[model samples]
Target: MAFLIKRGSKKYPYITARVRAMKSKLMPREVYPKLMNMDIPEITRLMGESEYKQDVDELAQKYSGLDLLEHALNQNLARTYRKLLRISKDEPNYLITEYLRHWDIWNIKTILRGKYYGAPAQEIMDAVVAAGQLGYRQITSIANMESIEDIKSALANSPYYSAIADYEGGELSTIENELDKIYYSRLLASIGKSKGEKLSLKFIMTEIDLKNLKTLFRTKKAGLDKDVILELLIPGGMELKSRDLKKMSSLSWSDFLKRLEDYSYWSAISEVVSEDMTSLMDVEAVLDKYAIEYASKVSHYYPISILPIYDYMLRKNNEINSIRTIVRGKKVNLPDEIIRKHLVM
Candidate 1:
């Protein structure tokens, strides 16, 4: 990822027109099923004919199997996101840059988790997608640091360093959650008095609702204590208020299902929230489906705004994740039915 060189004009009408064209080039939803039926080599051959061709071809001689697929996917994802920042101008660029910082948060969490799990620095860099304010050079330096404190010191001048404070190296999840809260909090804070900005705020709040919903589902499924779940939930959701979430978090698994009926998202998760389930994959996939589908639906209503860019970003990410999920599942010989259930499309 490269730095913003020249600040171009704030042309939503112009930028959005280009975004539509780029979005149209994204892999279609129907293609995933076909890819599922094919082998790795077959999938690679297929992807070679699509947008990922350059990435696959360039790495084809150096890697094979899952390695080949993962590298290609990560490279493409990083390049694709960086391209958005490169192409966007002025206000569009700012909004896109701010939104893309989520990837930076993701990279940070990946580093912390990798180190906590005793993973090597090289392994850590494999998962680091430098598509945000932090480029590959900065990320590489942080990943190779001797300790978390080293990372904190390296990031002291940045806005996200606060997330690393008060760390005792125990619950990395807590630090990860703090980083997320900071991202959404800072993003919400950045939205100003413009009508377009208000719509963006509403969109982000809705995302927070979905994110908080995922957190609740994971924690609740684990039968974690209410306070623990409450601590993990971020504030400022559009509908999933913190107080309401607190009350819901206090319920048992069965009672949690009953409580969910009071909210609008219940229909999306009801089928997968049964008391007998062992995994939360279905519920999470449904939530992802809800988010991307909702974004796609609402974006057309506000075409010449940040919403279209927002929608494209989510869809692009889903493309990478969905492809990876399928490829990884197939490589490990996971059951097709189980793999399909986890797919967002």
Candidate 2:
């Protein structure tokens, strides 16, 4: 749910057109296949020729190989998201910003994980995507913290303060879960009661459902207790209700898999299950692929709405991941086929 107050003004036409244009300029599908066949330097050269050329060139002086590529991709993603935020206004602004809070979750999670492991501030900062409400300064401040307690103190005034407060010095996964639940609950609450926000609502719920599915699957694989798993599942998903998750958590993995066949993700889940019912990687790959296809479908179905903006953001994120996979795979001399399997597209 987003807390966007509509001003009785409409500017979707302008924003939609701009987003569509941006979508068109994204690297075409064929480019991925070509990049898969390239060596690390060749992939770098290719990025140097693409829209990320500026980032590649600027970062090239300080880093090389996969490191350079990853840093460049992070910078490029942040830049693109900021540009989208700048273009947004009214309802679109609210919708896009709500979606972008994803980065806030990402930044906070990165900070927490880094602190948990005692990672260097620069290493944590490298992973921070300053595309959310939290700017680079705020994220940097959090990253510089010496401990989880210090990080929580820095975010004490934010929405995550209460969530982080309860989990101070607690398990990383618990803190991450609290952050997610808080983000989604507040988002839905902010959307309030409005027919106009229907599409955005559906979109967020779909995202939540997918995430819950992943979490449930992982927990089941780990042999976690039914009640523990149930406690971790997020509410407000489109199809997966609390009662449904609780029931699923109580069942065996095989029974849980059978139950999943009743949902929209059944087709995608079935493909991976058929391939290797025990392979988490295969299951995750199918899930990510379905997410891309679903987002694409939603974007096209509501071309003039705020969906395309979200669609662009997801696709851009996938691109960054794809590029990182390609570069990292090439650096390790992994086969193109294996590299392709790791990609979302």
Clashes of each: 0, 4
Q: Which ten residues in a row have the lowest lDDT in candidate 2?
A: 1-10
Which ranges of candidate 1 are over 4 A from the true structure? Answer: 1-10
lDDT of 1 by residue, 165-213 (tens): 7775766878898999999999999888666677788899999999988
Report the lDDT tens digits of candidate 2 across residue range 1-345: 233533332578788889889999999999999987777788888889999999999999999887788888999999999999898777778877877887899999998888878889999988888999999998888788787777777887888888788765647887788888999998887784444378889888888888899988899888899888987889999999877887898988778888888987897777667523665877788888888888889888877777787788888999999888888878788887788889888
RMSD of each: 4.4, 3.5
lDDT of each: 0.87, 0.84
Q: What local lDDT score does residue 340 receive in model 2, on the 0 to 100 scale?
A: 83
Candidate 1, lDDT over the whole model: 0.87
For model 2, the superposed segments whose C-alpha errors exceed 4 Å read: 1-9, 168-170, 193-196
lDDT winner: 1
- Model 2, residue 141: C-alpha shift (Å): 2.3
Cα deviation of 269, candidate 2, in Å:
2.4
